[model samples]
Target chain A: MATATGTARTPAPAAPERPDRPGPRAWLSAVWPSALVLLAVLVLWELAAVAFGVSQFVLATPSAIAAETWASRELLLAAAWVTTQEIVYGFAISIAVGVLLAVLIARFHWLDRALYPLVVLFQVVPKVALAPIFILWFGYGLTPKLLLVVVIAFFPITLNMLVGLKSIDSDLLLLMRSVGATRNQILLRVQVPTSLPYLFAGLRIAITLAVIGAVVAEFAGASDGLGYLIQFASTQLDTPLMFSALILVSLLGLALYYGMSLVEIALARRFPHIRADVR
Target chain B: MQSRQISAEGVRMRFGSGSAAQTVLDDLDLTIRPGGFVTLLGPSGCGKSTLLKILGGILEPTSGRVLIGGRPVRDAVGDRQIGLVPQRPALLPWKTALENAGLLRQIATGARGRTETAQAAERALALVGLADARGKLPHQLSGGMAQRVSIARALAMDPAILLMDEPFGALDAITRDEMNEKLAEIWAATGKTIVFVTHSISEAIFLSDTVHVMGADPGRVVETLDIELARPRTREVFADPLFASYSGRLRSLLEPKAAV
Candidate 1:
């Protein structure tokens, strides 16, 4: 048997200084340059269109898109609202279904093995290809669109939550056991809290996918939404309206992404140790 | 405080399959008196920790029986009187120091109320000199502080029997020494029966009332040495001739090719 060494007495070094906290002015200064760049790009695009004598039918100016947006303010807002509703409803359903599937899969290894291949099959098959079939099956209704959104949004959450639940520290489990903690207590106290970081990571990814899924389904067959508006403008050869609708879609996607990001930030702030990598 | 006796008789442990079965402990017998700080001192793979696990009711012997206060320990689930502190601090990262300490009471008493548990946790944290850091998470704490939290958590249970498996093994020498002093103080105040497992001879000698030397290859107790040191031992006591003599004897006992 090897003798134990008592001489491994190295002291840990002092932790390095954290960077200074940025004030509000510093934060504003950081974003000011990006705003300037955006302004420069818009000005250049508008000027080049006029200078080159490009037809407004083919390439819409930034101002033209803005004018289209202002002229069709009610239409644009209604479409945005419709898209937001689908995204929010789809995202919420995806979370509930994903969490349930993840819990079931985690609880039963055989079920996980059996259904995992099917889940992979669903994820791998492009939603664009599936959209037409979904429309055929469920008709040109919200049901097919919502189902498409669910499909796109569910996989990331299910995979991430499973990984999180399974990756709990063994020592913590042992500690709980040593304390005579019940199985329920172990799950509630240790497993769930430990998985929050990974769960949030998946939620962020899934939220963006929810919007993409909705748009794809809308593109296939829909009477309203920015996707349908974009398609309608394309058929009429109204480039400015198409650009305006496309801009609105991009803004919608950005809003959803930022909303999820803000939630992650709030949770991270509340549970700092859960997000140790953030700093 | 009532004096309770802890005993393990003819304990045996085996792991793995038929052909590859490896025995960890064989026919190990030991007894610890109430208020006695007994250290299981041995080389690595000597099953000192395995013995501690059995004593703490974390594991059951394949054969023989373990008794605490004359009650058999066949299962760990129903027992809340034994407190265990593992080698790693194992403090819950999400919970604050006080919260971690309070978890023991919650586990033991099943949440009658949080107020009493909170008070006990506070007292335990203060006893470990971590009152100022009650709001800090495990990651926010230094390693020494984290270990202290683990100690506080275990102590907050107010168990009659405390089992520590190399609780300060991961600390630096200075931190280890400080922890030893703190443990000694806590032990003095509580008068709890402590079964500390470690491979360090000096540490065993310094903290224990009696040290059980173990041997591997189907591990068993090879020897037990009594330290006749006075109570409330200080750092200066380590320099005394009697302490040196006891340590040398322990070192020699462990270094064999010698008598059991």
Candidate 2:
């Protein structure tokens, strides 16, 4: 709440003096070692490939992969874009549905008791085995890919949200009740804010799985996407192109993962008390 | 605002039924006058906290009834006549001390805008000598200060009765002593009925107009002693011979129970 003082109302603590920036010492201590190790690995691979005179089709060198990546940049970019769209859409839908389901499950004990087991059962069944069923249901379009991602991503989000809702301190609830807080008030001010950290924990895990889910669906059957490119390249013995596609897929996954982290960081900053781990 | 008289008659609280039944409070009876400061001083498991909850309408007694201002406690609670403070401050971590203090006003009317709550909270914080720490979060507060913020929260509600369950129990010796003085002052200033619970004899004698000593094993009130100490009680009062006598009497009452 904004007080008589003019400072803006924020759910979090006062911001730290300097955020999102590391000092030179921190950069040196954390970043340089990893960079040097990556350089060494690339150099070793290039040297070994040259010494063995290995065919690029059998095992593409780092240089060969880089060259192929540059030569087929447009194709790789388009595939990355398609895959990224699938993961983003699937993950977004999962958040909405998962949170809604969690709220309903937490509010009604009978619903939770009756449906929670079935939900867990669904989560446990190998999602990969359901790819064919999803394809049959939604056809070989973006719909199946989205459904697959939602299936994989939704569980953690729902489970974590349920835990968070139920984890409120009983004394706090009692206090709210004593003050005649309506049910909605208790949920908005107490349950939701208290559950933010847990929600973020689930999101961090769900987003990575979403990427994998999209790829798995594409691998099963797809007309476009990095997964399809991988399949097409290997069949034609285009080892360098296959390696490039694989690299692009991993890079896309990393980008999505980091993007989620940035969102989490922004949330953590707004509500510092929600996360003790925030620096 | 006028304070309300609270009466608990034959209040019995049972946890379970049949073979698993456990009667925590058996036929407890008490009366607290309007604007009076009363402390339920007892050991752990004595159901003092339970009794406080019953008075605050957070828990229903298995039998008997509680009334505040000649109305049922449940009805009174809905009217926002009772305010409760638990052992832990339990302030929302996302909110600052001032925001936590203002929470009662926000909930009382289901008001979305917090301007009025903020003004009321500011006054309450000032009453508790926490005006300087309003913007700090619960984690930024010391044990004593956090507890004070809970008190401010309760005070902001402007309830006729304040129900506190061991609000200062977690504080250290020095802070507890300081808090006792502050609470006594606030009680005098506000003239609101306060039902405070604690296990400390000196604390009870130091703050309350009357102390109700309770015993466990089917919790019930054993004795009620009136403290005739003058207003604005000070260190000199603690050193008074009457203070020692009261302390000695309470200790003797608790000693045999402690052995069991």
Candidate 3:
């Protein structure tokens, strides 16, 4: 009994691992096509810019942007560091608060009635439009950026979590209750596990938005960040610099998005029923 | 070992009140003998599931009460004395067959000693002939195998009374028959009382010592017939005149209008 409790789901006598799970070879096969597409897009954009004799101010060539990016690597990297902090902090806060609110709302009908509309209202309002208000309240700092991110990113988390909690089959819940499971037992064993796929779903959406939110927050007013770099470069009319900063922003979003997918994939290994196609 | 006799008295289940009130069950009373195999046979919308839920302590009757071995239904459930197998397999898709079967025992905070409960999972799986399939996940299992794992889960609960609501209803005829045999084997091996809910006449006759034929609107037991058939009923029994007679009687009981 103690051993069973210790390792919740390990087969007793070393059962074979799931054989059909994709390996590195499978992943490479899956990923290489997209990688090739990206390379082709870059090559085409570079050729188009050179052949058209496009002014650098109108559209910097891929090489010019890459050169500018390398030249100002130190400054851009520093701005990336600041932007990374804002997005990470904002994303984290959104998840924690969204999950907490979802639990409360799911458990209590009164709370669902009272607080859910507020949640929806927060979600429906244009968060970028509210950036100015947040700046006015918290000033041009990390605080305003995070508030906007949280305001923008937490809705999907809360809504998805709530749906997950309530979407169980009636028969399943009845079976759980019949087994003498307490409320907490049902929550921990059934509700929590049921909500995980939704958690990942919400997380995927929230992380991407968090990046946008961080940039928007900085756009409102900030001393330093990729967003600030864009504004500064725009004022100097340095298209190469502006293009490089935008590329960094895209890279940040891609990195965060990819990191989340990796985590989701790891989780899906343990809970194989979590469909990768939930998106 | 003392066996639990499940009994219900004056159990009335009504939803809503005033002119809008709708009754699902009314003035229903039942007594299931210890170590007996009983069947609740009824059509759809006949409150069979509701009655089963009431017996399992998953629902409270609008009036009256139920007892298992003289203990209240709620108390029995608290001790994990009532095991339920809903129509759906309800397996945690993430868990392998063994882990899913073992789940009830793991979550059951019953007074049974540690060593006793530890082997319950393995014992139950072996009984259901799933000892080999324990490593397989829910998605990998066939409909019948998944159903067997759920049976194993209920058995692992070590309950006094097992409440199964149309467990094989969703399967094809061949798979359903196979499951019926598997269930019959389990019931014979373990003398635990079982109250199985179903709408199938042959099924009621094949596995049950007594069949409680139920009626639809405001569901109530219209008739209770004891099957004096010999022990270890098999496919051969399906050809017997006695089996045909029992089936005819149950069919009439289920659909009086059609019979008329």
Pairs in steric clash, model 2: none
Model 2 bad stretches (over 4 Å): A1-25, A52-55, A277-279, B1-3, B112-115, B257-260
lDDT of each residue in B85-200, candidate 1, tens digit only: 88988776667778888887777677785778889899999998988778766666788999899888888877788889898888999988888988989899889989999988
Off by over 4 Å in 1: A1-23, A32-63, A107-121, A268-270, A277-279, B1-3, B74-79, B113-115, B252-260
lDDT minimum window of 10 residues, candidate 3 chain B? B109-118
- List lDDT for all candidates, in order: 0.82, 0.86, 0.85
lDDT of 3: 0.85
Most accurate candidate by TM-score: 2
- Considering TM-score, which of the candidate structures 1 and 2 is the better prediction for this target? 2
| Cα error, candidate 1, residue A267 (Å) | 3.3
Model 2, position A47: C-alpha lDDT score: 94
lDDT of 3 by residue, A160-219 (tens): 989988876677677776665677777767887788888888888999999999999898
Better by lDDT, candidate 3 or 1: 3
Give Cα distance to truth, residue A39, candidate 2, Å.
2.4
- Stretches of model 3 off by over 4 angstroms after superposition: A1-52, A276-279, B1-3, B110-115, B256-260
Summed over model 2, clashes come to 0
Question: Interface root mean square deviation for model 1, in Å?
Answer: 10.1
Clashes of 3: 0
